[model samples]
Target chain A: MNGIHDMGGMHGFGPIVREADEPVFHHEWEGKALALARIALAGGLFNLDEFRHVMERMPPVQYLSISYYERWLEGAIALLAEKGVISADEFTARLTALAEAGS
Target chain B: MTADAHGDADVALRVRALESLLLEKGLVESPAIDEIIDLFENRLGPQNGARVVARAWSDPEFKARLLANATDAIVEMGYEAVQGEDMVVVENTPRVHNLVVCTLCSCFPWATLGLPPVWYKSAPYRSRAASDPRGVLLEFGTAVADEAEVRVWDSNAELRYMVLPERPAGTDAMGEDELLALVTRDSMIGVTRALAP
Candidate 1:
């Protein structure tokens, strides 16, 4: 569970950035992602502890690269697959379908 | 699309897929998701926390109860949900200040504070808060006296924290609404002091 996500007191990231009038969620996608996460947890799909554990285990590079709700969505997908709610093949197929439709 | 844009689209797709998948499987209801989002997006926020701080400033009994049993006190105010089940309200006085951070991830009191700010989850804050509390506070434009002790709290799944910032001087007659106006999100998070009227 010890990973780069546990980043208290280590350094070099930079100063905290504050916007003039920040909304609760920066993107519409982020709101949906967060909603999915909350609903998934409420429905007994996965608990907070389990979700937090997997989030900590996310690839360090990805952790720093993605946005906050992006991480939440990724962790939710990983949990859904892990818990057998959705199979790995189905997950990949959906992603591929989405990408294909976009192009 | 750029990689980042593609990534964003990908996440959006996954969220939609997961929601439908759960609904099809009878695991969750669609309205529940809508309600949760509505709560965080509209009904909950630091404004909720500001109300609690304002009450504590005006009522000594409430402040004592809040400091002694934060979860109960906060719940009594009708703010109860995920990530806020167990809370510790640390008081800021002349000699001590408190800062809350979740080193492992963003563990926040979402029921009261709504979602955390982007910076609260940034690598910069996670890595530097505890090591340079004074410096971090300074960046937030809060310069604590050299003699005051800075206490950093690490929030987790089991317990979360919010700072009970010092009541600023010269507002003895202000009502709760006026007091609430002076309470900002940063003060509850301990990055800055509550504003003065």
Candidate 2:
């Protein structure tokens, strides 16, 4: 898939923004997202190629707008639902409940 | 918290939701998640790549093997894992420099180099790395000589790459441990040279 993710050679995005003294992860959630993705692949819910393909299928505008780990989170959730490990309604209800509790 | 903070919270909530659902369904365990996080944070990282680069600098035979067959050579040093199974180590000689990028996505040698930096996966970098490598290097404060040829390696899902940076001069007296300090993550990624001893 020649999505926006295949960004080689086309220009004008901007200069590279290099962070100083960057840590392994910026947010706590980012690490969790990474861990979930790795676990999903290791458990054979999806192969590495399938994982990359799902991320590539993300809507281009949203794909470019979201942060890196957020993409991981999105891909992992999509795979879990697709693999029948979890249902979309179950995920949505849980998300709503969590959001309400926090608010 | 600002608007950006609210946005982050929303994404955080989504991740929490996914995690909880997986746990409830018995698809994953909490302890397992922590173990994965700990592995990447503590056990696997650029320190492993630094060790490989340092050993190559001090031993000519190892360097030859590393350049010839990077996957087996790196595994011999005990740095083999999922994303790094197929490895290719490109050397930077006096006349040629090598830079690595994953044009399709963020395909990196995770077993050795750990997770990539945000800039490495950013659009500007993914786009310009292969096309305008010298210009990209300049932004990283790395200026290759005009006479040297710049070679860009586009890593993909199956294969990954790491740069074998030239050992700095005046380091003949330095041992492997000392050499490790001179080898940095950027050097292995070909964004910059090894630190001068």
Candidate 3:
């Protein structure tokens, strides 16, 4: 797929910013997102190609806007839903429920 | 929470929700998640790659093997794992510098280098690294010699690359452990040279 994620050789994105003393993960959720995606792939929920394809399917604007791990999370969710491991409605309900409980 | 904080919180909530659903459905266990996290955090990372680079610097035969067949050579060093199964170690010489990137996506050598940094996966780095590697290297404070050729290797799903950085001068007396200290992750990625010892 010729998605924005295939960003090689494109122009105008600007100079690379190197963060000093950068940690392995910027947020706790980022690590969990990575672990979940790895587990999802490892458990045969989806293959590596399928996992990357789902992320490539993301809308260009949203794909560019989200952080690296956020894309991982989005891909994991989409793959899980596609694999019948979880439904969209269930995920939404759980998200809403968790948000509500936190508040 | 500020807007950014709220966004972070929302994403955090979404991940938690996903975990809960997976847990409820018996698709995944909590301890398994922790184990994965622990593996990446504690056991896997650039330290592994640094070890490889250090050994290659100290051993002529190992360097020859690593340059000839990186996957088997690295595995011999005990760092074989997923995403790093097919490896190619490009050596940096007096007249040639090698840079690695995944233009399609971030296909890094995870077993050795661990997860990539955010900039490596960002649009700017991905786009420019292939097209203007010398300029990219300049930004990383690595100025290659005027006559040296810059070679960029685009890593893919099936194959990954790591740079065999030239061993620094005045390191003839240094041991492998001391050599490891000079091998930064960026050096293995070919953005910068090994730190001077």
Going through the candidates in order, what is chain B's TM-score? 0.93, 0.94, 0.94
Give fnat for candidate 2. Answer: 0.76
Q: Count the backbone clashes (under 3 Å) in each candidate.
A: 2, 0, 0
| Cα misplacement distance, residue B21 of candidate 2 (Å) | 0.8
How much of the true contact map at the interface does candidate 1 reproduce, as a fraction?
0.74
lDDT of 1 by residue, B19-93 (tens): 667677887777877777788789989999999999999999999999999999999998885654698999999
Q: Distance from true position, residue B108, model 3, in Å?
A: 1.0
Give all candidates' CA lDDT scores: 0.83, 0.86, 0.88
Best by TM-score: 3
Ranked by DockQ from best down, the candidates are 3, 1, 2
Error of 3 at B77 (Å): 1.0
Q: What's the candidate order when arranged by decreasing TM-score?
A: 3, 2, 1
Candidates in order, TM-scores: namely 0.93, 0.95, 0.96
